[model samples]
Target: MRRVPRWALLSSGCAPVVLTGGWVVAGRLEGGSYDPATQTISVLAADGAAGAWVMTAALVALGLCHLVTAWALRPAALPGRVALGCGGVAALVVALFPAPSSGGSLQHGSVAAVGFALLAVWPVLAFDPDGRAPWGLRRVPCFAATAVMGAGAVWFLIEIQGHGAIGAAERFVTFVQSVWPFMVVASCVRHKRPAESRL
Candidate 1:
């Protein structure tokens, strides 16, 4: 039972909302083209420089989101904390990289890409009614979470081709890193029964 700071938890979830939201808004601004028709913002891409800053902000936002979501939901969560911690470390490693010496920069950008997968795995395995999950199911997500984070580590050490340890990804990697936050929100909703069960 780790004691989590309230600010840390709030910041974690809120950061992603702000960063990702900001990026989307920025896109809409440039094109004046938030398409209600397609329900997408920034139907067209922005400048490369703008895109880079948006992705960087997003990476930080998602990382903090994982930590915060965990804290907020820790009471009902299983052993998935290991996943959260390892995934966070993995994100730090990848994000810290000028990223990977050898391959395309995408391979080296671990923070958002790998981090998103790891965070998603947490809910897949550990979430349950009122945070009371079957022991086996709990283990499954934990392992998945660890594996996801570990994969990022591997990317850092081997795949990056031995360059500097920190870097950001191209857009694809950023998307990979960020997609899970939405899923996390969904999983929280899945706990609705549990929330009511307590009542």
Candidate 2:
């Protein structure tokens, strides 16, 4: 089996950090009225908001990290890698099309939905059924992970329809999506063959 590279691990690990840090910093800079429970992260990057660049830069970095992780995950199936990379590109597109402060933009919502769906489904698509794959890439775990992400996405959509904590639901789904690559990379690194130690 091909081993995961150190750079992939680094990039994947940085994704959640960059996202959380960006939100915290943006929230701090914006001050007082920003409620994480009800508001979306994109609000931080909306037009005319203070510290918008912080969130924008974070989104760009997060997308690039996803692309890098996809490239580094050579052991996974090709279609899965393509889906992951395309998801990353969708994230970058989301950054490009920020929503307005008061309401959502159709383009931004479309790209964000695409990104969420791709990220949620990639794991299941990446799963190896041969039973020789790393722990994170195994069929059962991948299916479970995808199911959980799908549930979170449903909750987020319901929240968008004015049912519950929209910010919390979004954060839960996005944080999982951001962290999953790192888990997969770690599993690959842990199961590395003796001959592939250099990776």
Give per-model TM-scores.
0.45, 0.94
- Mark the regions of model 1 whose C-alpha exceeds 4 Å error after superposition: 1-16, 25-48, 98-103, 106-113, 129-199
Candidate 2 has an lDDT of 0.89
True-vs-predicted CA distance for residue 40, candidate 1, Å? 15
TM-score of 1: 0.45
User: Candidate 1's residue-wise lDDT over 64-164, tens digit each?
Assistant: 66665555545335556556655655544544443322233554444445655665465454544433543323445445544654455455444236433
> Which residue pairs collide in model 2, if any?
none
CA shift at 94, candidate 2, in angstroms? 0.8
lDDT of 2 by residue, 121-194 (tens): 99988887867688989998888889999999999999989946898999999999999989998998888565
Q: Name the top lDDT candidate.
A: 2
